[model samples]
Target: MRKKVVALVAVLAAAAAGVVVARGCSGDGTSKEARPANPNGEKPASGTSPEDAPRPMGSAVTIVVDASAPPSEKGPEVLFSATWGGSRMNELGRSRPDEANPEAPMSLAMDAKGNMFVLDQVNGRVVRVGPDGKPESVIPLKEQEAAQDMAVTDDGKVAVLDRFNSKSIVMYDEKGGVLGEVPLEGEGLDELGFVTGVFVDGKDVYVEKEHGPLLRIGTTDGQPVDRTEVPGRPTRDGLSYIKAGIIEPEAGRMYISSVDRATMQHRYTREIRQGSEIRGILLLDTDKTGTIYLATLLVQNDQESVVLSCHEPLKGIPTGTAVLPVNTMPEETFRDMAVLDEGGVVYSVRTEQGVSYQKYDCQ
Candidate 1:
């Protein structure tokens, strides 16, 4: 069984300097200009603030689908669809907000057997939804600052990264039994910033702090092992930290979303430095062949997202890739996304209607 993998933002530079500036990427036909360094050195405002950011609202939602595109070449097909947590009443005669009261989904992971573990950040619990798209079980963790991200293992063990607490990663068994907890302090804790990502590969668990040096831990005993620096750690100032990462252990490579900086380098690279219009990267694993699926968000240039397929690796420049847009509503705010073994991509979005999950099939 392969546990669910969530997109992790790379913690770098700004963190070392203790700043959170929303420096947009510039490349791929766009101008490469440096954002001015904050003089006072205070944290800069994000591109979108909480007040202006998109959120699920109202009592109903309108879903649109483009049926003309084929799943294989154009990306995943939406085989089945389900909705959760909204103001509208569900089959149980309870409004979504009243039933589960789920906040925006922070992170999610899926096992090889098609089981999904979703971190309901506001609720502080892991909701496991079966292949049928029905809620199977709910595992709650009490009294934590924030349950940020989660990953599942092939053997059915789930690991969660909870921020603000002394210990960061907590593991759980299939029956919701407590396995163990790993404290995210020591070594590069200060420079690494927060526990941005938790990945389970075979018997070893990979924990990513804000910057570089991804930590390896024992999955069975929860013991820390060697730490290796991730590819593309900046050597000087003016460079940006990693924005997000998707681990494809089987592929022997992890895809990292980063700023448009030439100084940074990675071990195995697939980049889309198409300027700020490229919002983020979403990774999906196909059950058909276990190949990694890469999707880049193009919010500014187009209202939809793009799915890319490339066989060759490029050093710096963007590749001539097959790009297909996944049309999404303008109001939808991508919270988190996970890839299913069957080449299906499941993602969470906050719309004016409410937070909900949607699945798209990939080839």
Candidate 2:
């Protein structure tokens, strides 16, 4: 019932990440010397502010393929794939299969070492995958039913958005030991409702509550640090409310995705200043320069759904767009998405054939 729905949702979420048909990029045979440092070493203007100098737009490229496309031999440059339905289990890299208790693999996080963690919603646990893609450990929750989202710290600690109880970000050690839980403390969060996304960096954890505001919590004692309203137009219909966040510690950038009604799409937009107006209405990963992949279900267009990617930015401005092909398995519907370390995305799609793998390379 609920567990089955969660399993299905997990697979769909994988498809949302654009994991179909593995691909990779290669460099040309020539090399050039590095450019000299700027004499002024001046910082470029920010992309949003008029006072800031405009940043250079990088070149865009796309990779498309049919079902017959061959898988890469170099392992996945990026690993994004689907999960098993009705089982609290998921397969990684076609190698390791992990089983968490209660069988609800809702969210995923990976570390620099290639270790993966799956938020098991039904069993109220988080299962860790080792470097070899096998189950390493599981963090158990006593009463939490729906552990919705997750993020991994640079140090390998896991932070999770526990939706059912208090809706707080719970921190755990790499070995599944409980560190703390940060509770939301602000207006509109009294109910402690569902948290759709969780992101961790250093000792800070950010939680995005569904239909509510975003909360910043301390990783030390699970205390609320800051609360701010999300700046975006409210979505009415055909909206997928799976909010995802990524933090660029080096650039101090935070990227968040929300559903947009104008295009009847879910697009990722960057948030520069806290509570500031969000201007960049494009889909991009943390790198900000890679391919922009999208999973769409255009019900108005005869229920036609497919995974798509664009090398160019997709905002109010018009740019060239392209669609990547994937083999469709009956009964599978694309769901949510996450970018993997290897420059590819992992996505979950529904199919009668059960959960399967699809890899794409950004040309």
The most accurate candidate by lDDT is: 1
lDDT of each: 0.43, 0.39
Per-residue C-alpha lDDT of model 1 across residues 1-363, encoded as one tens digit per residue: 011111113333232112111122222423221111100001111232224322211111111122222345433333223344432222111123544443455676788778777666555567777777666777766455456667787666888776566366777888877777776666656633445467665666666544223566446446566554443222112233233232321111223333324555432333222322434344422233323344444344334334332221121212122334443433211125675655546655444344455665321
lDDT score of model 2? 0.39
Mark the regions of model 1 whose C-alpha exceeds 4 Å error after superposition. Answer: 1-103, 191-194, 211-213, 218-221, 226-276, 284-290, 301-335, 352-356, 361-363
The Cα RMSD in angstroms, rounded to one decimal, for candidate 2 relative to the true structure is 16.1
RMSD of each: 13.8, 16.1
Estimate the TM-score for candidate 1. Answer: 0.56
